[model samples]
Target: MSPQPQAAVGAPLSRVDGRLKVTGQAHYAADHAPEGVVHAVIVDSGVGRGRITGIDTRAALAQPGVLTVISHLNAPKLPYLDNPGGYFNPQGQKLRAFQDDQVHFRGQPVAVVVATTLEVAQHAANLVKVDYDTQQGSTDMTDAPSFELMNYARGDAEAALSSAPVHSDRSYTAARTHHNAMELHAAVAQWNGNQLTIWDKTQWVLGAVAELATVFGITPESVRVLSPFVGGAFGNSLRVWPHTVIAALAAKMTNRPVKLVLTRKQLYTNVGYRPRYEHRVRLGSDRRGRLTAMAHELKAETSRYETYAEAILDLGQMLYATPNVSQSYQSVALDVNTPTPMRGPGYSSAAYAVESALDELAHELGIDPIELRLRNEPQEDPAHNLPFSTRRLRDALRTGAREFGWHRRNPKPRSTRDGDWLIGTGMAVGCYPTHRQPAQARVRLDADGTALVQSATSDMGPGTYTSMTQVAADALGLTMRQVTFQLGDSAMPPAPPQGGSITMASVGSAVQAGCDTLRQQAIKLAVDDERSPLYGADPDKVVVRAGRLSVQGDPGRGETYRRLLTRNKRTNLEVLGGWSPPSGADRFSMYAYSAIFAEVAVDARLGLVRVRRMLGVYDTGRIISPKLADSQALGGMVGGIGMALLEHGEFDNRDGRLVNANLADYLVPVNADIPEIRAIYIDGEDREADPLGVKGLGEVVLVGVAPAIANAVFHATGRRVRDLPITAEALL
Candidate 1:
């Protein structure tokens, strides 16, 4: 069957909330100020590990405007229920804020000061004194005391690797990375008796609501979380952090609403970050570049309290299709806040190691990198033994090559020199598995000729509002201006957390269901009403278009929805839309694919590497918004550039300190660092993934990007660096 007439989907539609954002009307978490709201400032533990021996808050309480101070000594211990389902919670108790005197990591919140103003709160917090008995804690991943290997196997990988005629073994490491969003980690909490309401910057509001309710020993319904606008999350706000709890506790203790905002320095410690990864790979291939055996080991850092994990072994198992494959994964506990998912998470880091190895193998075999990949492309998912719903990676590679003029380049390293710079071209394959979760939405069409859609989801700077509006507009045959899409309120219909690249597939399917159901209701009414012009028309053939219900073959014989609803004495027609995972989903392997191409210029004399241009060709299924898709592609590339050459966090294991915690010290890409970027998407659909035919696109755009740039750098200079931020010193 043909799809619906798409007037909004696939169109270059601008964001519906663009005006609200640019005009400063958008209110983020810190922007909310309720009646009698106070401020809360938190104090950090100076010691890495130990027990607080003493506390002195007399000076802080004596200061003017200081409301009160909270510490483990004076704070009430109602409940600290276990958070077993947190994205990265490990066995044993999760860290409880203000529950005890024991400190688990440096920068742990030891005390909080509340005051009438932010300045007074900060000053009072500084005046408060705390003394602790210090103990040394292990903060280095390489010096971990214990290890437990995870599960992954195929045919005997060790035997295959030893028997193979051509093979290479290499190691790689990625530095820890912080998610420095435009907005700081903040929360505003207000409690009216037992009911708790909070405005916090978070990626998962429902998770926050659940955690807060469990901690306070209240019903889930008693807690409400609001995060209407988020500057940027990148998975940092996916979990319920310690600071959020501090804000709520301060508010409840003082019997007034309280706001808490993390300083730039504090943002590095409490909020989660992308863990540093240590990767080792041993791969073998035939003369034609077909993979024979693949074995890899991955180790990443986590906090002593929580064990974090992501999809890191996916590529080694199935990416290139080998007869024998083995993967060992382990998490090294350290004295830091628990790590969380950051853009692309494990796949992006794994790609840097695997793609770079593939490029090296291709160079050794004198085969074009693209040609080598084509030789090993799998007919089905090698790991799951399932047919792909859609895999257009070949098409993306061909198109990207054609568009980027790949044929004009020389493959030999340092061969294409232009005086001060040696230029080269490189490409890598990208993959990110598709994910879906149950979602619900409520749609209402009023007699006033307008529609309202509500869901408990978040945007997080992804243009979710505009894209969702487009989905509803097309499904219900309504113009963009006539529809209002609302999100980020717990009062709305239930929705999955808006991360893991699942929002569009999960929430969008629900939106389509709601819109289509509401439209069908209108059609049934129009076809059955004796007073309507379309009476006696078959309901099966009736269609809604431009607010009018008409017979499929004859559009002229129809009545406007406004007239129908008014004549029936009904104010609105409402329906609840829901989506469940398809039963057949398990029969197919679903993933979004991309072919990233990059050109680089390296100065041999000064050891400087610069990206000249970049192109990302994606096989993400069924784009609902072209303009938004293009923006995502560009943004992903920019982030990849930073990952390849600039972004890295320094830590002092001796003191359990993140050395470059502030933006001024930490490096990220600026406008002057990026070059021209182009994004092209293969037009296609994946019906098996969802009703909307969308595979997750957010994570796929970032995968393979760092590797593509690194390969280009290797081609420009004969050096191969196994660590991240491919430094100038390494190039030299």
Candidate 2:
């Protein structure tokens, strides 16, 4: 079959929903207001761990407009049925709100106050007091007991390390960090008997439906979720949280629509955060800096009830061509909410340890960092024993080095300085495994010459709406203005959870398939119709351009979709296109790779570190939307800057309560802190990975970012800080 004409797919188009977002017309979860909707405010426990003793609701009930204060003592028993859970949910019993007296974490919701207005609900929630039997809890992972979750060994790493000529053994710590998306976690639930409708801020609407249905002991089809827009998530809204359950339960109890929006403080604990990690990496290399053996040990924080794990060990096993590699990953049980994937997730956490260790080894061997990485580049994935789908990491490193002027940088730390500032440059390779899940998109071509494409995917600041539309427009041979892409509704065709950087490869492929089907249907219709201009033309040789189906190389022998569909007496043509990871996909190691370079300036007297600039060259296949990809890469660089110099989730060890929960306390890179950031996408495609020839991009951009910045800091100060957020105290 002839391919559809390429028009919109590679264009650097602006987001189709940009106007809606900038005009405040895009309705997020909290913006939704069902008629007669009541407000609910969750009253969370102040103690880290304990059992509820008594609840007092006299003052709260007496307050005007206060409807009800529900707690474990007075709340109805929910079925709390078992759920298999989403991709990100840990394998354990989930926290059931208002149905238990046991408080496992400091911010566990103990009660909820419902009122006519949000302000009234807040007031009542504060007034309704609860007493707890507080017990000391282990919030610190350093002293907490941990159990091994994963252990892998390809060869005798210890023996090889002992025999190697050079070794660098180092421990690294990454502090807890919050997503802190601009939009707070919010849910609005309206229940008509057993049928439930919820407007919630979530990356996966169907995931929320399943969880809510299981919690209420109802069928999954009875729950409907609508989340058209998200301010930003960074993996924060990927799971169904307690507040969503609270909203639905409150609405059921009150027989009115209930809206629950978490405050900024509540967001810090109620939603998931990046778990604190402690990683120790021991590397052994030859005189030429070729890795001989590597050993990795990592322990991350997780709630006592659940075992949350990520891809922390994969990087150690397959990232390079080490002859011997052994890895152990453990999760430390703590009195805190279960952690979830943040931007880059486990890959970013591991990159800091592995890449920083590589940098250390390079320094010890007097070899350039880029040269060391090239020396250790693997011909095949040593862990899986598979060839790479498309490995261009070396090209990315070379391109990035050339673009960033790496040749001019001094090798010696603290060698380049300007007045009171020390200057340094560093680079690190980034990689994230390419992921694709089964996804389906529905496409409809109306007789009016317009198309509507929809999937259950989400746009949590990644421009899903625009990118999918681009795929649809080109596949259907329609102009961008004639095609619309809709998402974030559970009622649409099913799609996998919109995390893991797979949406484009999965959902966009589905969209393209659906549009291609519709376009082919139009061509068949025209060819079969004797009255149509393209009568008796070969369907295989027909191609579409701007809604007109024409014979290949003969533009004049065609008719518009409007003319053909109207003649056929059909109102619209519809098709459901679907895609799944092809069989034998595991035969190849698929990953998106990048080379991130950072330049930093360290103040001599003040010990302040400021990033001067950053450049990221990526080998992520087939840029779907260049503008959005650049935005994603640049944003990732800024986030990496924060991870290196500013962001830290300060937990009070006494109670596991996050002290710096608010934005005022938690330091993110502001505009002033962000310097010029540029992103480059290599010209290539990964046909072995997907039909679209595209590998995932979102997570890859952030994978090696923190390490690049951390390595740069070491170059600037001549001091290697093992801990993240290399603070001023360490520099001083």
lDDT of every model, 2 decimals: 0.88, 0.91
lDDT of 2 by residue, 1-732 (tens): 888889998999999999988999999999998889899999989899999999999999999999999888877888886545544778888888888799999888999999999999998898988898999988998789999988999889999899999998999999988898899999999999789999999999998888888888899999999999988999988889989998998999999999999999998889888989998999998898989999999999999987888888888788899999999998899999999999988889999899999999999999999999999999999999999999998889889999999999999998999999999898898789999989999999999999999898888999999999899999999999999889999999999888889899999888888888888888888999999989999999999899888988888889999999999999999999999888763879999998999999999898899899999999999999999999899988888888888888887888868899888999998999999899999999998888899999999889888899889988998998889988989999
Candidate 1 regions with alpha-carbon error over 4 angstroms? 1-4, 85-91
**What value does the lDDT take at residue 284 in candidate 1?**
91
On lDDT, the leading prediction is 2
Task: RMSD for all candidates, in order, please.
Answer: 1.4, 1.0
lDDT for residue 145 in candidate 2, whole number 0-100: 91
- TM-score for each of the candidates: 0.98, 0.99
Query: lDDT at 553 for candidate 1?
Result: 75
- Clash count per candidate: 0, 0
Per-residue CA lDDT of candidate 1, range 522-558, in tens?
8788778999998988777776677777777787898
